[model samples]
Target: MAEERSKVAAIGTFASAADHAECRRLHRRYGTTYYFATQRFPAAIRRRVHALYGFVRVPDEWVDNPAHTNKDAQSRALSDYRAQLLRGLEGVRPEEPALRAFCDVVHEVRMPLEEPLLFLDAMQMDLTVDRYETYRDLRGYMRGSASAVGLMMCAALEAGDDPEMLAAAQALGEAMQLTNFLRDVAEDAARGRIYLPQEDLRSFGVTEDEIFSGVISDRFCNLMKFEIARARALYALADIGIPMLPPCAQKAVQLARVLYSRI
Candidate 1:
């Protein structure tokens, strides 16, 4: 009994160390802005944040990678990732260190499984959908891809279940996602993806051809400005929830919001 217990303890320690290291590596490589913001968090919270980032980064890469030109292949890969994530969430440690670490954090924080599941649903959409017909349509995607992430963060921060706070977090997530879409217009175009709402494009008289051709016409500029204004509005809403977080977590969240808005 003693020897078996010792073996189990050793495995736990090794897994914990490996998991943290993997999360750190993923965060450093893929999320410079977010990783920088995490530095302000208390040590325990920082590590958990890293784990969450790492968990999300894996499927994001699979979906976004230029080499995965085959939509069916991307779909299959995302499905596999979802399966592994679900297993991890259920307390079955996945082979991947990042997944394992994320599982540990989820279990530790008692995060709802539905949050990550919703994120996977968004990734699945990426496989089949390219353009959003309207802002409302885009919001549906964001609910899974972005808002779910915010809720997950709230769970990690132990911010309690306040309806207003969750709504603010959702707004913040949408704002950040919109900021990224604006900044990555060229990059996303190269990937044959357009995150901008089709309705907005039509309203601004910016054609898909203009976007694909990298034309920064006056119309395109106006469109971008409009989107930025919307994102800023969301950021304002998000700002209200910052003070609602525990004092120790408030600074990190504030820094992240400011930095993302700047981008």
Candidate 2:
């Protein structure tokens, strides 16, 4: 029966039906725009992508809105998660299904462990660093958070070895991240975080008070326009790598790029 075949397919190499299902759920709930683009991918690739999203989202959540009020407790919990991820990468089966599935994808794609570690480092930084003095400073953080994730995705797509592809992927990731910072400015400000670089704020004559107070001044509008244009430039740079991807996978990536850029 079709149902039986589907059930059999659900038992992943490193995870179970429920595990992959959980990953899918997280991706759909939190990354709705991305989820739409992912649906265009082949089923196998979609599953792997979902697992990757879930793996990163867990740590991001811990740092962003932790259940524990104590900073030390939050740090310890993040460290524990990182340790488990390392163990999984070392061929030890993780007890958590998200880790299990993500590790399986890493092995299947021959992805390096360095990318995930870098991502964990970024999460740790979020605990202590809330504001960036310059775009370069923010970029340093994004190297571990956004660019590393793009590199991981490149590996997953079997295009990691190409330098050009990696460059473009990195640009794409940063562009998306910048978009997120711009969109979440108020929300992040409320949480005592400000992702926009201080230099840009100064250059545009926008102050933290205006941002925190939700004051949409002409200066703020100009600042946002400037940042939006910058994001679009990065998207343009990323476009160069699309043709390098396999024909079967190109459309999905393109769709994601288009949708995210629109946002």
Candidate 3:
């Protein structure tokens, strides 16, 4: 039956990458701005790009998995990811389906060499740095982990290297990250990670316990305002850049950022 064949294909396609599902599952589970924007990509490109996100997500998982493991094993897992990524650059077929799909898109889309590479590089940085003391430190990590993604997505659109466009994209990327940092405060703290800048904490006279409690104090509210304002500014900046892309692409990116801003 045609229906049966369709069902079979869905299961077959999805099952191939079940081990690393967060990336695609995010597409399925949460149709937020990011995923919805992705849906607007060319169908073939969308699938390939989602696969690329999956590969990136798995490395993210190991660091935040909460399964609690020895450092050596975790190190090996990241090293494996680095190896897989490097292999993709050589035009090799990645054994992992996500990598396979990602490779196809990167090659066809001409995504920047550093977008995905820098993301992985940022993940490596995660294993070592848990606290950021300054805005510069945070920006450095965002450059690799978040800005790189924004740049890559633009690359997927074959946009020329317009500095203004790149700046807006990076701002949008950090806005998303800033939102995430607010929501995941408790969980990150559980894993011994604190994304709130040390200076901000000091300025507010808030300690780790105050963050873990989740009770809103005036200081806490003030601190949250600072982060939210940053996200808002980035969203504003992205508006300018979005118009530069194809109209549909611009809409998709707009939708994606708006959806995540809901967080």
**Count of steric clashes across candidates, in order:** 0, 0, 1
Distance from true position, residue 11, model 2, in Å?
17
Model 1 gets an lDDT of 0.86
- Candidate 2, after superposition: displacement of residue 100 in Å? 0.9
Candidate 3, residue 262: the lDDT equals: 87
Which residue pairs of candidate 2 clash? none
Candidate 1 residue spans exceeding 4 A from truth: 1-15
What is the TM-score of candidate 3? 0.85
Q: What's each prediction's TM-score? A: 0.93, 0.93, 0.85
Q: Candidate 2 — which residues are off by over 4 angstroms?
A: 1-12, 66-68
Give every collision pair in model 3.
33-256
lDDT of 3 by residue, 81-191 (tens): 766655655654456666655555666665555567678778888888899997778889999888887877776666668899989888888888888888898888888
Q: Once all C-alphas are superposed, what RMSD does model 2 give against the true structure? A: 7.1
**Between candidates 2 and 3, the TM-score winner:** 2
Candidate 3 lDDT score relative to the true structure: 0.72
Query: What's the lDDT for all of these models?
Result: 0.86, 0.85, 0.72
